[model samples]
Target: MSDQHVYLEEVFSSIQGEGIFVGVRQVFVRFYGCNLRCSYCDTSETRAGNPVICRVWRGCEPGRFSETLENPLGVDIVADLIRDLWSPSTRHVSLTGGEPLLQSRFIRRLGERVEMPFYLETNSTLPGAAVDVAGVIDVAACDIKLEESGVEDDHGVLFKRSLETIEIFNDSDCLVFAKIMILPKTTVATIMPAVTSIAEINPEIPLVLQPVTPHRSNPERLIEMMDAAGRYLRDVRVIPQTQRVLGVL
Candidate 1:
């Protein structure tokens, strides 16, 4: 493995809150950078500066972050910590971010060192980087960013890149799925382009519509969006942020 180090925000054990893997236990290794700024983002703090220290939830207790480790952590060190936090029911070690693909090299090395499965939670805008780490990924929750959700993709370049990234993962051995964040104002027209593109890639790929948390969710809108998706896709489901409802980290 290479001696590459990664800037991380936190290392914690928590329920998989988003996507099809919701409620599954995971060891979350949150990296510290992102290329996009979505208005409904919950972890925007991760997008700013490199954290000097990473808060680690060391025990089985959820949200009980009792330890801190110096930043720019090595792959071996991160692997060890993940092993320590992993439980019998732990489904995978989630390489989440502000955009984990930003540190693709570091993730490649971590994949080499860590025995557990890697679940990548990414904003699918980095197909090149996705190519670099795709072999190592076991499951991918690729976000399909919608314009109505305040994703700043003016020219739709990022949207195209997102589809490309998803395609890359779909071609790999990794189990891949598309996740779209639905805001209160998100309409069928707002999501059509993304939904149609995903269908083009492979309609069989499961599509998850996640309502943005803490907002007044429109159930009717979600139903309409799902109906629209059903024309091009086979499996479309509405799954909100269950971890937020469970009051876990």
Candidate 2:
């Protein structure tokens, strides 16, 4: 297992920018690669092939950066970096990605070795992979992509898996929540089904309406979608990319 490692983009500490866990301090272990490329996506690094090396900061402080670590970094090494950067305020070890679920075994193994709680930030399109790690994850921050999300996915298949992923968390003690990227073209027709689908599965799970970008925010549209979602789901909120606003990594 010393040679076995997961490809990663970066590992750093920052606040939880979206979902019900927003504002909580977290150490983000961002994995490399993703299945879907949403047009409005801000995770630009995820679009490329796996990096030959994984970058980490020398310290947990926001701006400090460390020498790159080789790709497919051993679980022990990844575990050390996470432990090194963890701070007193750190809430959980956030397994974010290109799609963290893509590397289910790594997450499962890492969760076993780490002392911190594991919080998974994922695109709920991959239910099978979600199941692979669901048993180990402490909090499931699942993103349900809508048509307005501009990802290359079969809507029926996408929604079905999204439901399955949510249900995976529902059947467990993991805190589950959904975040839908509400674009400018996003309309009630496009939004209702997602909220309705989530409502049908578990209305108690919070839904976060995040505009494509925080700089050119469309508050009216965000509010409208929030209002529309509020009808079916009890806990729906409009949260912008506060990380982008506060200028934190």
* Index of the highest-lDDT prediction: 1
Q: Which consecutive 10 residues in model 2 have the weakest lDDT in total?
A: 57-66
lDDT of each: 0.89, 0.82
lDDT per residue (tens digit) for residues 1-249 in model 1:
134888889998888878888889999999998988889888999987888999997654555789899988888889999998998989899999899998998899889989899999999999999999998999999998887767766638888899999999999999999998888778899889988999998999999999887887887788999999999999999999987678787
TM-score of each: 0.95, 0.93
Model 2 CA lDDT for position 64? 67
Residue pair clashes in candidate 1: none
Pick by TM-score: which candidate is best? 1
TM-score of predicted structure 1: 0.95
Runs off by more than 4 Å, candidate 1: 1-3, 59-63, 153-155
User: Residue 26 in model 1: shift from native, Å?
Assistant: 0.7
